[model samples]
Target: MAHVVTAFLRNRGRILLTRRSDAVGTYSGKWAGVSGYVEGDPNDAEDDARRELEEEVGVTEATLANTAQPMHITDGEREWTVHAFMFDVNHRDIAPNEELAAVEWVHAPVICERDTVPELWPTYRRVAPTLETVQTDDAHGSAWVSLRALEVLRDAASDAESWEVLVSFGRSLRDARPSMAAVTNRVNRVLADAAGDTEALCQRAAAEIDAAAEADDVASAEAAQLLRTEGYDHVATLSRSGTVRAALEDAGPSVLVAESRPGLEGVTVAESLAKKGLETTLTTDAALPGLVADGAVDAVLVGADAVLSSGDVVNKVGSYPVALAAARADVPVFAVCARDKIRGDDTVVGEEGGALYDGDLPITVSNPLFELVPSDLADGVVTEEGRLDSDGVERVAAEHAELARWDESTSSGADAGGDG
Candidate 1:
């Protein structure tokens, strides 16, 4: 199969408009959006969006989704289901980069009036309508909260006054690290409960996580080795033996890749895997298929930042691409994560629907944090309890739905920068 790639680009509004640089192949300078070539792996749309934005416009990881949408477009014979994102920019001036010959923002009507690839027109026109609908849908409206809505919920959860909410939020951060603010708030909740005071919890938790960061806080290196010896196996994880690294050590030797980014999760995972006596081979974002073709990979056991309901998983920016590649290769992909990552609502089309925008570098940037992998992309989910399929996602969610204290409704909560 050819590259079933996705793109993330700006249009109307404070659009990070630019002429596509001919530095790369394919559509060169004909004025297309930020595009990516699929590495014959699973397509993680949100992450691709983030990566495209960053690679093209030098966006920081802070503000990637001001106006983001998951859309598919046909470019002649090639078909790409891209996550089209928009952001507001107040640029004093405009300039082009290596991938973009120029960058600018214009009015929506004028943008709509411009000539385009023609094949992508329908997908482009739907952007505003899609954004409007996804933004307005309330938390109670549906189970799958659009990506934009997730940001709102994270904000609401962060502002929550209840200690349980805060602690739960903190556990969310540690278990998933989806949103730093949410995690901080949750950590504060834990400290607040312990100290019986709301003040100064953030300062304290940081201190603890930092100290904990030094010495295998989740699992001692010795303990990790013991777990590895005692029928536990480690899979995909950060390079160090934190919680994720420990899990990979317990599983040992997974078919992995080097996840590059503002934060390189794969570098950490690869370095650690080598230490654990695992047969780990690092590959590029594009070489996934070749490995699969060679039959070198047995299964995909990756890590996650959060696992949403409705069977969608949020992971590193590159994780979705890897999963998409794996899925296409007919290899089963299992996410090795704790149950705590299950967000307020899972069914919400997390990354596929929502995106947030924050200005990074200058006024031009897109720093997407998480990619949404639908249950379909996953062969199974491996938790501490064991491995389960996407169907089990709904089962666990439904079981939790009965808990009167838990709200499984569609969350109007904004999910900006909520991803790890």
Candidate 2:
């Protein structure tokens, strides 16, 4: 029920505008950004954003961030909420889409000084604040988000219909109540800027922690500080999250085991569990049926790359079938994750990472880092707050959405991916 749009601005003080090629839809003849009234389309905002951006300015997912301004206005009896975004890109050859006579790069402030579309001006003013970009990236080389991945995962999350994203978000917030807001704020701010590298991320985290500390937000600030420190250690190979030990501690007994894919990640899982004093039975992809049919296991725990709003998990290639097997056997399948992996209510696990796949280009394929496992198969989700149900997840998420403050340095969603 809202109208959202995006304006891609370049750092050289130029804003990209598109003129009306056809005059049938809203504001046909006027110049606009990769702008459009949001279809209010569930689970497809990223896709819509990407499509519009490319159509208007010929850019790809690796060029924008999840930062947009909400412009609320009323045109006669019509009311709209357009989220105009500021996207920066280097200057390149421009091929104006027939709608406009010409395209030029002008200072952002000049948009007001120049004689341009009347309606477009107001949109710029309101959108500018939202586009102020909480974090300023000096590097400004290149930036991007998993536009397509976000689109596909959001669709799967909604279509599953068995789980709602709010469940997990609420769970995170509730459990981490004191510090959630600050954490999210910091993380969102980092994301807004073009700071994707490891150093920038840590710097962002440290800044957030300092902010929290100043605000006297001890719990979250401390968490923020921890992540910044730990995250830096991880990237620099300075510290580790206990490679095999953690999995074994969580798996309990190896009987309820399923291997992850890509690099047979399950080896990490099985080895970790074995070290942790569990009866681990490591099996291959085919052995799933025999084990489940024979009533061999009581539960399953798998790692994930991302989680959708509808409680569908995007895990490794083998994860989906494991979930299916667990469901058929009436056994509970749980997912173990740390606080950094949590993105709002849904994990954004498989989304916003990269082109689904990138190994062999030219023949580019979508290499989603995970698969969707419906909530029905998910017996519970384990996080720092202990095991949470779908509803418990709801509460935790609600509790933390406002408080789960993350800085730029953490929650990179860098560890895993799923099958496309």
Candidate 3:
């Protein structure tokens, strides 16, 4: 039996696929991820996977996202056990070794059409986010969940046999993250615009995924502009928000990050910003509001999981306190997100987390994943379209509500059919 490792390098919602060259010993002229024989013991699979990524594609700093159970394949009297890894790379600079002839970065679903080695798509599936992953993910913000929702729809579109099936699956993705308006709005837009056409739906979904990512980028730009305009040089934030990170990076502001409890996502954010050369301070969640009130933080910038029609923001649990502190200190508080994050209604679903204490005591502990920040606390909302006033927020909320009409229409049709 032979052990090998396949590394899928992902960037900006796409994975890297390389065509094997004639110089390769096995599966020559076939599409594959970065693959090579695992040197030494099978326990060395992760190290070998990293080695293969650097050796084959010159990716020395890619972050390992996931690893899957080993898959066993048979080829003409030889058994092969393949270890799969998915890595997140920051750039697309590829210098393929002699083993690869060509390289392309494409959507994961596109791999279904390529002539690849044994069970390539299946192996990719093992590492990709499923409905469950999206539902249970606590470390990432809503934007990340929304992107994963799109990935789920993309995978379902590849396998769905009919428009009805695709719509059903899209609805499932929409509901996967109940508190995330971006996920619901994006999935709803794709379903409604598709208009019962599977091919068109898949195409639109792919485009929408790109558009969603671009929306976040543009929103971050808008926030960065606001930071520049207001001369808010020191920003305080909690939790891990990709949008917030991008905005801070672009605006070049020193940051005060709260170590959000139960997850400590802010530690990751602090480390990331520090690596980017931004002066970042990591503090306990309890200390952040005090710092903001003490005039150490010039502004409070947070990412919203859902922006309600009332202009209230649903975000990580610690956001409300930060916003309150900023408000008391006369510091401007901004909630940054794409327009799709604005929900049609004021409905807030607060998800409860498991108990952090493992003791045998019978005391009840409460841990909510998110909380609501009233509209008055936020000075402005920075979106892709720029800063939104109350009227602008209402308009965007109405647009999101309109996008969700497809669900109501579908339900009505189902009810009518049942009555018949």
Candidate 1 residue 243 Cα shift, in angstroms, is 4.2
- lDDT agreement with native, every candidate: 0.45, 0.44, 0.89
Candidate 2 vs candidate 3, lDDT winner: 3
TM-score of each: 0.40, 0.37, 0.95
Best by lDDT: 3
Model 3, CA-based lDDT: 0.89
TM-score (C-alpha) between model 1 and the true structure: 0.40
Order the candidate numbers by lDDT, best to worst.
3, 1, 2
- Candidate 2 C-alpha lDDT tens digits along 214-324: 322222233223333333111000001121124335323344444533345456556655666766666676676557655676545454334443555555555666667
